[model samples]
Target chain A: MFFNMQLTYEIAGGDFGKAGYASSEIKKVLKKLNLDLRIIKKIAVALYEAEVNIVAHAYRGSLTVEIDTVKISVKAQDEGPGIADIDQAMTEGFSTASAQVREMGFGAGMGLPNIKKNADELNISSEVGKGTELEIITYLK
Target chain B: MEAQTFHHALTILTDVCIGCTHCMQVCPTEALRVKNGKAELFDNRCVDCGECMRVCPVNAIIVEQDDFSEIFKYKYRVALVPSVFIGQFPRDIPTRGIYSALLEQGFTHVYEAEHSAELLRESINEYITEYEDKWPVISTFCPAVVRLIQVRFPSLLDHMMQLKPPLDLAAMSYKKHLIDKGHNSDDIGIFYVTPCAAKIAAVKSPVGDESSPINGVINLNFLFNKTYRTLKNNDREQCPIPEKEQLKDFEMTWTLTSGESTHVNRRSLAIDGIHNVIEFLEKLENGEVTNFKFLELRACDESCAGGILTVENRFLTRDRLHNRAKQYLKDVSEGKRLHNKSIDQYKPYLKQHINIKSIPARSMLKLDEDMGEAMKKMERVRNLMCFLPAIDCGACGAPSCQSLAEDIVQKRAAISGCVFIQQSMQMKNKLSNDHALRIMEKTWGENRFDKDCTKKGAKDES
Candidate 1:
């Protein structure tokens, strides 16, 4: 109603074959929105990393993206084992992925770090054994 | 960024087009739209790949060419022929006969278009070695692929190798040779016998380079028919055709599929056909493809052998070229020095001027120049999509329903173009029956639904 656009996608867990589908779709829309290619690529990479994190480490997840003229905000909520130490999880090369997931190359522990690097803002909250909610925001300007 | 004024060689004969929508259905870029009983082309979106020409039933799509007599104006008329054209002759027609036939057709000299392909290969290897960060370098060999990247995948333009194609190098080398031999530049006219519409477009409007060295272009089908008839009708044995140096084994098959990839001294992939190239480029843009140092992206199925202007079957021409290459290889192994003296002598000069200045991406994907306006328009497009059927039926004259929606938002078309919507409005008494018929006729043609027995495949056809 305020001239803001929003998109939501239901991402299935453990479906590594389809991890990048949502990110690809989002990239297409952003391209149509005439965003700079550099910004679109950064958003796509960060969204893909977040989506793959859900597939490799969670039961299931949903991603919601809010778009305005000034900025874009993404929130990913997953139902799975939560991170104990968010700082440690954010550290590069600090992956808690299973041996199988690592072998498949899905769990590069740079997920949270990369999101923070590409996005202008990042926030994380989780319960011990419940789930995790990751929020990322990037300014359009 | 490059300017939006693209010179396309493919021209649709509007009077001859029957609004069949065949070309619209198969276009890879959705650049075609049928209106007023003829298919219209969006100049910026068309890459001149000639898929429309391939599918047109009534030969309405045609590639423009220089007049045949245009070569006669100059004292030195050089016929720059592609290897695919050479492979079109029958078995009885010898290679020398092909050259003699060209000589008979007012050409003072003949040269293979891929003569400098070897030199081009060396330059590409050096560039790939120097610029490892720009891995998976897409070849600018296919002019259609170069234009495709300019329009659809602007971001990947950095990965394009900034080098002129073999045809340009060949033309440059020959021109330099003629000048060195004391021929006046004004008197020399280099005409290329093009295998496809894309090359003709490239010759007319070169990208990444200042201007094409070729002065004119002759359609492959037109030239091939003339030469074939000449070789078949007359006794060419007495034609003093010298035993000139043959094309190297590599040069002979350079126009075939996978030919360029195999020559590249890198981990490369050769993808042919416009659709296949588009799919692979999409994966490349998405970061799915890796470890490739080179990409030979061709717009035709069997490479230049499948050009729209070619006369022979693509497979047959490919086999003939390979067989010709095999003979050349056999001659090489038997101590024959089939060397091109001009190219070898002009190697340093060609190498010195090999690199293209710049190729800017003119992306056709963006809806508007401003991000805010594009976003607003995109929102409107999404809203319109909810009301339109996604069946992609071409009855509305646009290639797909999405195409119609975008056109509507752009104000180039209206929502009433959809037949289904017109029917719904008519049932609701919102539109008169005559108004609905008028809308359909406006899109399809005037009197399009009439019973004409003269049309193709009609029951009471003439």
Candidate 2:
């Protein structure tokens, strides 16, 4: 019989040091299920980059990592300054992180692209001066 | 699917945990949860990556490693050594001496993984040249980096270079060699000389589509002290590792972040240090810096030299890596092309079944046969998160404040799991009531609606 589990991690805005916690737990769950390593990795990357973006760019947010026998899905929502340009942001290498983020070794702008790369399907929506929402899914058949 | 059977290999003692949340912040899997008064561990989600054990300040976390007694169980043991071992010892320590030392450790045979590195380097170069149009290709060398991508950056899976890691390649080669020598395959066991807990976990429970070629992991730290003492009396240079000319240069290259770039002259990017690499990979994903053809990312600051389990200083280890790289340069010849046919033959062996679908069992854990229980659990989780010091210290058994809350809500953990929450609870019941209603109201809004509707509500809250 197929079973499902949903886990959540809160991404604190401006906390670069605490990034990727949710993604890490999601990875652990995927691994325990004996899913393919490559596929698990793809889910991990997408979830992590999105989580980091929430902390670096958003006011605050939470990442819900949902896993099941059929697929792995991550939904991240943040209450902060949202993306100004979804198209521009999706382009590889585009980022708005500040120097402090760079000092912490983030802000290189691979967050979105990496997310796109790992998930079989990705949908993101954001409003400037508002918050952002991301939905990512990776199949596990 | 039961969470109980999933062992908690990495752990923290409540009194010493300190609740810093560093483990939560750095954990790639989001496995930790901090609740009421202490940290609680979740079994079904832990990968045993050991990042928690490495980052804990009070030494509260401990990682599980196999004992030497495990060696006796294998009939024929093979050692899979990482290329970074070249930098750990004195310059005078020859490869033969190292091989002989491994023999003394109960390994029936020793194969230098450097050959796999050479094979991987050639394959990557050929692939990059053939697919030059592919923008910003990422390296598949580091297991942790790969896992980070899988769990945190799945969208970029296509960007990851399609190559087996050096250890996997080496294990495949070792198996082929064993078959050629007419050894019983079932009797032979491959053991990786792991440099980090992540590698140990990788060998035990790999993330991607396929199982690891190696049978088990032996931490270098667990063996280094004993092995070094054994080397004191053995012939320092008596064993042989074939000829330098026969060795593949790719293995030599796995020592540094620029290792891939050294082999292929492409517009590649390389970054060491976990946080820095994450940023660089993020930028690469964001299209902020799009000129590179390949990216070699490492989790450790000095590449493998800074692996969590290594004994040597990162700087010194890096210096030694440089010295070894230079020595290997003499062995490369333009005539030295990797046998493409041989590489293809090994493909079926390395390729394993992978499922890109979301993990079903995990998602099932989220559902409550009882909606009321689930809602109540969500309330408890939200309350726990609100009280979290927000330090993400990981002192709580869970990785973070939110993770702790989720665990509590899911009924995997309890309210008193976070020490800070208990401290605050003791200080004043008023603190608990401060935003209890508000937090619950927010949870109802965010959790009860779809993103479109939730977005509208979330905007107002923000």
Candidate 3:
């Protein structure tokens, strides 16, 4: 089915103050759509974790969200130094965050795991010396 | 469906309101709005925290509590005194004197809310131990905070501790005590000497229960002068009231901030002040604040002592409470523990069937009534926000730039309401008008055209 609506947001890297703005806005949109609270919660958790990952690691990122009758799809692409090993990074308690980021409690290595747990489907693609892109889809049910 | 009746404990007198926007600015829930040059409250959105009452400079906002005279209607009147009310008096007055003063004022019996708080404390400990997996269990004692969760944090509703507030529990315990003493339940009326407007509302319309055990709420400030007079007129030589054992230090400190958590004695967080609580709740909802078993959130700045209806200064009252608690602890250490078995005897009055229902989101904040249209309008609002100055000056009659953007999209307001937009539009129109006149002058040679056009018009008329 065609998407009923779409929204996009620009996220600046290291901008901790506004890290969750996009996810919160999407959450509000989903709430207005009258989706199940549990579904909205899962989407919020997944999107927020992905958004924060971009802010913490990437130089800049853009999040594009599409909502349809059946599901919500989110695509986040960032311009920054790419991950060296996807498998290692996805492991719990594995982090390459700076000391400053760790101090701010962002480098718990739970971000990807949390996103994976909440999203129905998650796709990650990255190239060395390039940027990273994450695609997350959550069913309305 | 029948419309739900909300308790408007805090009301604004429209005639006295100055429309200064101070209350609207400070409101944590964004419940207040300056409409038609007056402050208006959305009843469903308001939590009756008395924040507006405190910020209103003209004293237009008033807390509507039950009249103290209403207690006379009942044959048996019981006063449920909050711990904060006891700390409001001078330090020299013995706590027993306050009890006797209540009795002298025609109350058949007076029960301290602290006792109920102790019971609730025990219940909470048991609840935490049993539901150990439910991390970050929020306190349900503050009616305003509970209502806030209902309105703003509906997702966190399940996290709320399902227990009756101290005031309600106290009334229940008092009723049982009176009934055990052979007085009929129907003849007795329970009155809560409340420190805040939220408590008054709670008594009138309880959160979890269909009706409250508390029949009426008398504001502490309203009864302060009368209680003081009663204490002053009493003869010191004739002490008719027996001295009861002082409350434990932890129970006595229940009226102040962080007091509730000190009893939990675990990984807990105590957040006071509505704004601070809102901030913490947002973090909590986002899964930022974890590893804590309990969260004691109070809507008032210094908890109950900072209530708007209280007469005494909070800091001073807090100090006095601490001193009294220290004395009570010293007495307890001397093998003088008060044997109050009521805590163990009575169970919580919270009904197993009834629970607090979460309220729906306020429609006033919605961009459109239709979800699809709202999404479209949300996009438009985003575009409008880009053009806005983002200064949140409130010059456009909206609280912030983002709100103005929403108002513009809702068609309740026009983009021209923004001063910057209005000035730019005016300038653009002026520049265009000037350009049109300049073109007319250049094409028609100013004076020559006026003369030639007039002559030609006269010839054509002839």
Candidate 4:
């Protein structure tokens, strides 16, 4: 059987207190649906890292989650200074976060790598003066 | 699979409840709900933290404990005293004096829970040294914290220390001692003097152990008045106090928070209070907290001393216990002949491995029993929530606008239950009615209707 549902959440930048609220809510929804624990943990990790990236680096962002029987697809679009070099940004230990952001024990250049490790498919597109958008999908089967 | 046993030590008196949301809001597990002017507990979700009992203004919630009278049925009665119980009294009172008092109250033998804690600590140290892979081994001493992990963080089960609690160890040890002295096992009854309701529930229906070695649990608050009287009336001032080696400073400190982490000589952190514990566990789950060999998480603020059933202030008691521990160490340094045994001589009483199982979700937030139906309802609820005011005013008798939307999707409530929706609908009806009246007046003048009505009436009269 196949089913689908979508949820959207707005993420405000520098709101550290509510950074993971969206991911946690989605995790609760998935748990109630009786999904496997391993699958839920993987998706939660990837989604949380993506959500935190928006809060730490972007001015403001929005997350649209598409959930179906076989997979969960997440798209995060942010209105912030976009990445200049996609290949370099994808590399571990490379970051363009501010000093204040790094002081908060984030922006270790591990966010994208961690997300890629958990997600089955990841796509990134950015405009230097415009904004950045990321799409992540993890299979539930 | 065998059916799991459910035990709840909390009871609510409905008549005294004011339908206040204090308990509902403070519950860490969201196990409580106010329905129809009364508080109801979702038994499977409650961790028996007793936070509701502490927050209730009218004392409507009560902890259920085994009666002391039940101990009389056995030929011999053993009292397993948690170290926190000693902190309830004044510092001037000798530790041996309390043991003598318990014996005076008809206990065949009195055993300190700290002794068992010391044994468990040794075993854990050895276990950690051997299994270095499990760096962050969470302590399993606090029953409430253990249950919280079982319910909320099932993925972290492998990190929990696989050992029985100190009270269970003490009960098993005393039982063996009596049996060795030619006493029948059936004739002896072991009762733990507990500081919290969680321990009572833990003993009755334990999550890890196959069955609890302890027979019954008695609340310390219930025994305080009687023990206080016994301590005052006993006149043994002339008798020489028995000299016994007290537990090490580290062992005695187990009654309070951060004691285990500091004593174990490892990289560790201790978190206390249910809210703080929950927060820390979330961080750990998110991979934010690392590099610690152990994590001591207690549900109560100041560990067992801060339990709801405890009478004295946790800080003052902690100070008194620290002073007693210092005195104990001083006596040991002076070469006094105090009866103390080596750690190697003591064997584990747990005997069998304790298996902790994850609790299945109750799915209270799910809209239906079936996953597909629940997903459909969730979509509808989300759409309905967008139209709500989102003020969370509670005027509709639900806690929040989101909850009202959920209720509507569940068919337990109607959208009109919202005051704003009802007002808008009434306004629309009034405006439409006025519009219909205007159209009638425009099509037919008011005087024409009056003349037609008069002519029809005259014809009927003729």
Backbone clash pairs for candidate 3 read none
- Candidate order (lDDT): 1, 4, 3, 2
Report the C-alpha lDDT of model 1 over B1-462, residue by residue, as the tens digit.
211222599887777788888999998778888887778888888999999889999888888889999998999999999999988886667888899888987898898989988887788899999999789888999999898888877778889998889998899988888999899999999999999989998898888787899999999999999988888788545764743856787888887888888989889999999999987776676665779999999999999999999998999999999988898888889978656557899898888989996578776767788777777787788898898988889999998888898888889889989988888899999999999889888888999998898898887765
| DockQ comparisons of all candidates to the true complex | 0.51, 0.05, 0.31, 0.36
Model 2, position B335: C-alpha lDDT score: 46
> How far off is residue B22 in model 1, in Å?
1.5
Q: Write the per-residue lDDT of candidate 4 for residues B1-462, one digit (tens) a residue.
A: 222123488788776665666787677876665555566676887899999889997778877878888888788888788778888899888788887777777776677677766777777787677667667988888989988887777656668887777777767766777787799999999988988989888898887567888888888887766788888986765532333535666677786898788767788898899999988877676665669989899999999989988888988878877887788788779966377543223364343432244333333444576667778878888789878899875545455777778778878666765666656766878435444433333322333234433232465532
TM-score of chain A of each: 0.90, 0.85, 0.88, 0.89
Candidate 1: stretches off by over 4 Å:
A1-3, A14-19, A55-59, A80-94, A97-117, A125-132, B1-7, B240-243
Q: Scoring model 1 with DockQ, what do you get?
A: 0.51
lDDT of 3 at B127: 77
Q: TM-scores for chain B, in order?
A: 0.97, 0.70, 0.83, 0.81
- Of candidate 4 chain B, the 10-residue stretch with the lowest lDDT total is B440-449
Off by over 4 Å in 3: A1-7, A14-34, A93-108, B1-7, B232-246, B337-343, B348-370, B383-389, B395-397, B407-462
What interface RMSD, in Å and to 1 decimal, does model 4 have?
2.6
Off by over 4 Å in 4: A14-18, A94-107, B1-7, B129-135, B235-245, B341-344, B348-370, B387-462
Please identify which of the two predictions, 2 or 3, would achieve the higher DockQ against the true structure. 3
The alpha-carbon lDDT assigned to residue B191 of candidate 1 equals 99
> What are the per-residue Cα lDDT tens digits for candidate 4 across A30-123?
7556665667668778888888889988999998989887778999999998999988898987778788888897568988888898889999
lDDT of 3 by residue, A1-141 (tens): 232778888999999899888877776666555555567667777888888888988999989988876778999999989888988888888888777898898667888878888889988899877899988998875
Candidate 4 — which pairs collide?
none
Q: For model 3 chain A, where is the 10-residue window of minimal lDDT?
A: A28-37
RMSD of 4: 12.3
Ordered from best to worst TM-score, the candidate numbers read: 1, 3, 4, 2
